[model samples]
Target: MAKCTAVIDIGSNSMRMAVFQKTSRFSFHILHEVKSSVRLSEHAYKNDGYLQSATMNRTAQAIGEFLSIARSFGARKLLCVATSALRDAPNAQEFISRIQREHNLSIKVIDGEKEAYLGAIACANLLPKMDALTVDVGGGSSEFAVLRNGKVETLYSLNIGTVRIKELFFDRNDLAGAVAYIDNALSALPDFGIDTFIGIGGTFRALTRALMKKENYPLKKLHAYTTDDVRFQTFAEQILQAGPKKLKSLYIKTDRFDTIKPGTLILQRILKYTCAQKLVCSGVGVREGVFLNDLLRNSAASFPANYNPSVRYLLDTYATHSDHGIQCSHLVKRLFDLLQAPLNLKADYRHDLVIAAKLLPIGIGIRYYAYQRHSHNIAMSGLDYALSHTQIVLISHLLLFKKGSRSSSLIPRAGYGTLLPDNATVDALSAILWLSHILLAARINADTLSVHYIDGKLEIRGKHLYLAKEQLRNIVLPKNLIVVFQE
Candidate 1:
């Protein structure tokens, strides 16, 4: 086993340390993770170029603690990065010199474009196939990088972050002005033609937490979440109007309450201008990016195969109904194709629907009674798998319908844009998936269930599906259903 590698990220709002220990070939285990709210840029604005004395002292103490922990854990390599706050301070060089001389730790102040690129690398490792607009919102600046086909095409760094906005606009209670400031800063970047957006940093995480609570999301996992225009508008308004007292009631950390308003507005503005339909919340931020960079630098050949764990691997490793889930996915794809003409479902939407169908059964193993609810619960609760929030919401909706329920409104309250299938389409797919599961639960095997158009009617055929004599006789097929037996 290889020794752990640690990376320390000293940011304007927070400082964090993470350690990764090699577990096996192309696999690593997280050894330790810790974060502290140092807010090094808290009053750095008052000074010409260096962080205020108090802020610098607090940051140095945090770094010392992190370095001690890394050494105790026998970390062979350590990388420390400081972002905007330290980079912009007039006395940055002096501060860096003092830290290096006193602490024996080399600190690199990364530029905005490099920060955006590194963040994108971390995201790309997580979602290999996505065409994403990666947005990292930090204390002093927000970085944006467009990943087309898993490669960075464009990147920009803007002077807009939660702490920056809070310092500039919150005291005046000028919410509109804050929004304008963010919009103006972001407008300078050329459009990247992005349809999907991935958010990184504390503000994005805070937003995910708020959306999870509002929709009663079951999973605490953070990856991709879907937010619609309605949900976005509603939540944005709520956050804006909420006073500290009211916000605290929502269980948001007191320190985060003030920044939530401006952060939400910034996100809203990004979504509005980019026309992104889906938002993926990556838990990995600058720390993970830096760690990954070090990992690759140390041993490029030993890099993990899947940077972020996969849903399939998770289902196989931890889930009990993995086999059944695969069967359901296969069945759903067949039925989806059969009804595509009548349902008017686009190819991309159908692909997501099939994925939802396949993953639906993972929740049933929790408990038998109200398996529908359990299924819904598992899908939304971040299961340490690589799934966007929208995909999870869609899967939860399908699971609800699969268990003999018809509530299409059970989906979470994230902005999913147009990524979800229409209600009618979802209903139709759910009905077919449920019927197929009920028809083949006992006799499921290699044979595939299929639907077809025959003589102006939809027809279903499967070796085992027709063998259910009781269901064939008693089960009432929908008006559109036409059953055919193949001997």
Candidate 2:
């Protein structure tokens, strides 16, 4: 595989180019990106599947510009794929041939099923592992991939995207007929006892952004942001009632207001059709899927099945030192074994404990004072895609108190009634992490210390206890746990 590969995704609404820099197998990030809203479906669908000349010329121009940008970024290879609008266009081969002849760019026009598969590839590897209906609402069509047990069980593509729906249904005065048509198209979709909807593509992202803005959400990241069915229903209704003149006020993109409402209607029906209760938005789509598939084609390239993508991204981006974090994680695992029964904690928390241990000190690099709160902010905002929102909140709380700093004024206040568990579990987890920090801060050899739970009292048997005895005494712990220091 090339060190840097450029992926150009020609969709119905927009043509986008993403340059990915591969740091390692299954590890990469977008180095550069560019997009142009060509809206090929706007003309092609209205003109009997014949791609309009002006639209094709505009697409050719965008492709030429994107290719230039990619080359300027030192891209070593290129993978260009065109979706629905091009696939359904009668003269798509002519357009592809013209680009090839004029600019030496070979564009692969993928079928609906292949497009759905590529979209699923991205969702399976990058998003949280779950049973979901991954819906990619493009401009010319919508691709649905039903993921069961993290595998694609069914794939379907409907010729009803934002642009297509707007062209077909926006002018219809018979509201009942429009809904009936939508329902008839959606009736073919089957529900697999799955209530989670994973929404991909630009329309869903715009909705997530607007919803986040409305709530004054602190985190700006989009992946794995979930919205309840009630919120979505309200928004969908608002979009349905909003005219193009009023759409700009709804926080949708100015260019997208014309079609966003139609998109929302399509998504609302999809939610009902699939009996899904919640929608998790993903910023990734067919472009990322294409890149990942092309990358893994090389025999030496692969990603770990259990590795958390967002976790690695956060650690690589912000962490100053990983040795301490790794050592603390090891120490916490050891304590979970020794303290689980006494603390009344279950093994379910072990996964969160490990993640919190590694991420607890990331904020120290920003500043030492109030570093735990900083770490909390980083985890809440940066670490995502693998854990549930509840797990994320719990992990943030665990990291907040990891350094033994339990101030009443600290962040993540106790007002979230049921968001947190009973205080005992939090205290125990905090104390265990705090103890791990102190034990290692004493410069004791990581391998020399062993924990023993004796008669409900905690003791750390180590080779050099005398050297750090005074520092250990200064640290605070959960008052419930009887701690013993023995040399």
Candidate 3:
């Protein structure tokens, strides 16, 4: 496998490229991404499904530039797939040959089922394990993948899409005809009894992004952001009723003005048919799915058990002393175990504490001063895979604790207060984490210290603990607790 692989998905409405560089086995991060709204199916739906010369030329030029950009990042492999437009076009072979002759880029035209499967693979592996129906609305087709227990069960694709519906029925002002077409197409799906809808592609993302802004969402992440079916259904209806001016007021971008209604309608119909209870927006689509399909070909198309890609990428790229991070991670858990029974702390918090300790030094890789702030930002932005928004925000908040700071002041100032646990819980967790750092400030082996909580005081017994004792002066112990250090 190449160290860097570039995956391209040429959709009917846009052509997108994502370049991924592997940090280690089964771990990688995106290096570059480029999207061009070529609208390759602009007139194809109405003109006997023949791709227009103008759009084809525009798409070819964009692909040429995408190739150059991928090479600039030293991408050693390129995987390009075409969906909807090319698969339906009568002159698709001509366009494919042109790109092959001019830029030496081969495009694999995938069928609707394969396209749905690709998107499902991305959601199955990258998202937290769930039983949901994955929906991907493209320009000329809408795809569906049934997921069961974190695996893809089946895939279905419909010819009803934004551009397809717009040209066939919406343009003629025949709303009844459009609804009939969508309903008839949806009748092909069997009842899966799934309530969750995992949305993939641009249409879902654009609508969700607008909602996030309207609600003043604290976090900037979109991948795992969730919304109930009723809230999204109302928003989708608003988009359907709104004209061009109203869409702009709703934060719909100018590029999406033409097809936004069609896409929204398609999702609304599917959600109603499937009896969806919730919708989770996925930032990754066919491009990411294609990349992982090849990358994890031998590993049952899934990451190793309990291995998080974001964690590995952070450690591989940012951690300067990974061994020390590992040592501290173990020490924090030991401390948490000793205090859990004493302080009445929930055992669930140990997960965040362990992860926080392991990633503590990630900020040092950016700068020695205030590296914790850097770690906080990195976790918020980079920890987008497989974790919920709450977990992501809590992990970042853990990095905000200083030697002596109140969680009450820190929680409000940091924001995202609604997504976090209570201040008392956070204060306790922060105190444990900070105390662990103090104990290992000298980078000593974790085995050197032996700690146990007895009655009201936590006993710390170790040799050569002079530096730890000195660092303890600035620390604040949790309420109803005291620290006793002895050599």
Candidate 4:
């Protein structure tokens, strides 16, 4: 049975609800998601640190709709959080009281420190292995978390955001003013280890959109977006000079265009000050963090022996289909190992090849006409957690090769950036995964088959390999590759 949990995040600029259905040990499928731009912080300055009546009413209506959806989905638990604007508002208690009385929902206004900590937890669990500085930019504030070896080292929240910055320095067209404001805000905080910065929230999303347009990125996945200093600076300058009217022309979303410039400026300032080479865009944020924290607490209390929700979910999802995937992966690896000496490929190439082998059969549900294409589409579209963009592209390309398709034309060019693999490596890995899939289809229990080099020839040995007579007619082995089946 699938257990569902709903998390509603009320931000200064928008309100979002994410419903996660527990599928397996560490796997949760996103059941439903809804976002509405309420702009609660629009009048924070005018109202002198209080939420305005109009914004509060709209927010209440949105939350009511979100609650209905959550109940319909049969969510076991619901977590509602208000950040930045609501937390800072002088009349926040009044707003909370009204929400409880009218909607029967209690709103927890979390402090900036807790917000930053939760964001870090989500990133740590999502990526698992990375030295990341998680940054969440909201309407009224921005949370920065420095993580080392998947553990939070330090965190800080600043009074800087798309809406907050716009309110403070929107009138000042001078680039120096924006830079100074950003520098001053960041300088006060204790030093955070400078490494790869993981950007979250609206500003980061807008920056990614601008980069995607500039590069003509074909893939819509936001999992692994890496931008160098030069590219970041170039886009920042363009946004600064063109203003909102010109930004709209570039197809930037209307709701975000007005704030994008300010947001970009903030990102650029942080990057320049930190002297980081690249920015990684993370789709996960405060809402995910909130849900994750709740799960962790529950897991600790209820199942002390089996703690860690993320790991549990991952194990459960993989248990269903991992055996076949691992079998194919082993065969693919053995084949690649045998050919590695001859192909002279680097060590990193093996990772891409193995991932391709695992994901090849994932598209069996779709029609076989272009099932490889469908598999490739699913991989490039982004996985639920942690898998990077480059990893997805490589896996997608490998799947494409299984169908004897040209990966260059099918895979998107822009999302890869500088990490794009060499053509020779791509070709070799594709061939290896395709052959493994072909061999596996013939014998479901063919786990003993091993690929090894015998006098410069690739040979497959095992009882199943010897018994499979259809290999001669159905299988098309790569040229110059000799396959010897041993009885």
What RMSD does model 2 have? 3.1
Against the hidden reference, what TM-scores do the models get? 0.67, 0.89, 0.95, 0.87
Off by over 4 Å in 3: 412-414
Superposed on all Cα atoms, the candidates' RMSDs to the truth, in angstroms, are 6.4, 3.1, 1.8, 4.0
Put down candidate 1 lDDT per residue, 249-359, tens digits, no spaces: 655678787567777778788778888876778888787777666556555412354334445533543356447666766766777677667656666656556665556
Q: Give the per-residue lDDT digits (tens) of candidate 3, residues 1-487.
A: 8999999999999999999999999999999999999999998988999999999999999999999999999999999999999999989999999999999999999999999999999998888889999999999999999999778888999998899999998889888899999999999999979989999999999999998887888888899999999999998888999988999988899999988988898999999899999899999889989999999999888888878898889999999565777788888999999988777788978987888888888888888798888988888778879888888888878877566666545775546988988877887887788788878878888888899888788899887778888988666677777999977
The CA lDDT of each predicted structure is 0.71, 0.78, 0.89, 0.73
- The parts of candidate 1 lying over 4 Å away from their true place are 297-385, 389-487
lDDT of 2: 0.78
Candidate 2: regions farther than 4 A off = 172-177, 244-246, 298-302, 317-322, 360-381, 393-404, 407-409, 412-425, 442-445, 466-468, 473-475
Instruction: Estimate, for each residue in 79-115, the C-alpha lDDT of model 2 and write its tens digit.
Output: 9999998899888889999999999999999988889
A best-first ranking of the candidates according to their TM-score comes to: 3, 2, 4, 1
Which one is best on TM-score? 3
Better of 2 and 3 by TM-score: 3
Candidate 3 minimal-lDDT segment of 10 residues: 406-415
For candidate 4, the 10 contiguous residues with the lowest summed lDDT are 300-309
1 versus 4: better lDDT goes to:
4
Best candidate (score: lDDT): 3
